[model samples]
Target: MQKRILLSLIVLLGACSTEKPDTVSIESQDDMKHASSVAANSTENREEVSLSLLEKSDSKYSYKLNGMKFSSNDRVLKKGSVVQSLSESGSGLIKGSFVVIASQLPKGVIEHYEVNEIATSTYRLIPLEIGGDLYELYQALRQNDVFSRVEIEIDYSGKQTSDSF
Candidate 1:
């Protein structure tokens, strides 16, 4: 009887210990809840844009991202990939103190994107500015304790125009 009571208490405490899920649980493609079973529609050796990494900063950090939006008629990004990071020279001021990737996306649409969740209230969104940034997607990946990999999607439907409007 004592053993039974102890086992019951242990199970009860285990259930209440920690139930929260990890933030970066989507490391593998199998983790995708609704991956498009309709084979990806892309091409080979196609012309694609490249993104440059933002330069490193010297002083204190500034700017907390609120929202990010990137849409191109040619390709749409998945819900967990990070948009390519802009080279420090590209942004001109803010450097590589922070980065962003996709956490939630609307639907199948834009081709390239990099969105990362820095904190509860802050998120970095990288929407490709031009076609040249596509090739640079791999370079943007930064292996860190917080961020593991930048998830993305590539679409080659022959349309290169970004859906900003």
Candidate 2:
């Protein structure tokens, strides 16, 4: 009786297994080809822009790259200049420190920075201090050649206030 039961279980498991040929639908193949073509065209259209590093200064730093002001350090940046340092309040709905997300995990990140693994690609960076200097930290991360891309987190809450209009 036990042998019969075992045979029945084996048959049920075998029936449940799904082993089929690795075949994709025609529509899926066409979609993949279209995506590759679009990617190639977009890459051909992209133009490279370069940024030059300025002299090292202790009393903050500022520069205009492609007409965009990059202000760094604790010093109060000029009006309309892009502030590189982490800000508590300025323009965004949730104005806070700069959050750095890399395409790949970077090495030797500052001890103060906390790394939260959202997924294989996504990571959330949080500092112990709200006023931590993230711009400097970002520059340090950029120097490492291992990371593909590192950028600040932009707030896109889509909350419309009176000032927006």
Candidate 3:
């Protein structure tokens, strides 16, 4: 009886120790292909455009790139009707800041900037007080080739008021 029990234990242990061949599920394989294709298409569509500084003053600066206007004031970066408000009234000041809307951002750029993800693929980037200038950040974004659209806020002279948050 002892010999039989010992043999049974050895057989059970041997079966448990056997290694199965490494395999990936079909769903995971399909997912990987889809991700790679998306990345490839995004890189293929990337094109560099000339970013020109239009005007600069003590309080604000205006820039133009590919027929889109961008303006930055003491607090926020504006593009078209979208205003990415960086600081609230009486809050700490933010400088050398901007917004980038893209499907994906590089790991290095994400580490360098103080990022706020306002929505899916939309990011508000605030630079540190000492380093990472606005133009440098913009160039980084362009180099990464992730942005679907370049939309910068244009200031309107008409008075505007917001009653709801």
Best by TM-score: 2
Q: What is the C-alpha lDDT of each candidate?
A: 0.36, 0.50, 0.51
- lDDT per residue (tens digit) for residues 1-165 in model 1: 999999999999988866676565556676564343322322211212111121222222222121223322223222222232222211221122234343443332135435455676345545555334332333344332243433333222333343421
Poorest stretch of ten by lDDT in candidate 3: 47-56
Q: Sorted on lDDT, highest at the top, how do the candidates line up? A: 3, 2, 1
lDDT of 3 at 149: 52
Cα RMSD of predicted structure 3: 19.5
| TM-score on alpha carbons, each prediction | 0.19, 0.35, 0.35
Off by over 4 Å in 2: 1-107, 156-165
How much does candidate 2 score in TM-score? 0.35
**Candidate 3 structure quality by residue, lDDT tens digits, 105-132:** 7677666767788888888765544443
| TM-score (C-alpha, index-matched) for candidate 1 | 0.19
User: What value does the lDDT take at residue 66 in candidate 2?
Assistant: 20
Specify the poorest-scoring 10-residue window by lDDT in model 1.
45-54
What 10-residue stretch in candidate 2 is worst by lDDT? 47-56
Candidate ranking (TM-score, best to worst) = 2, 3, 1
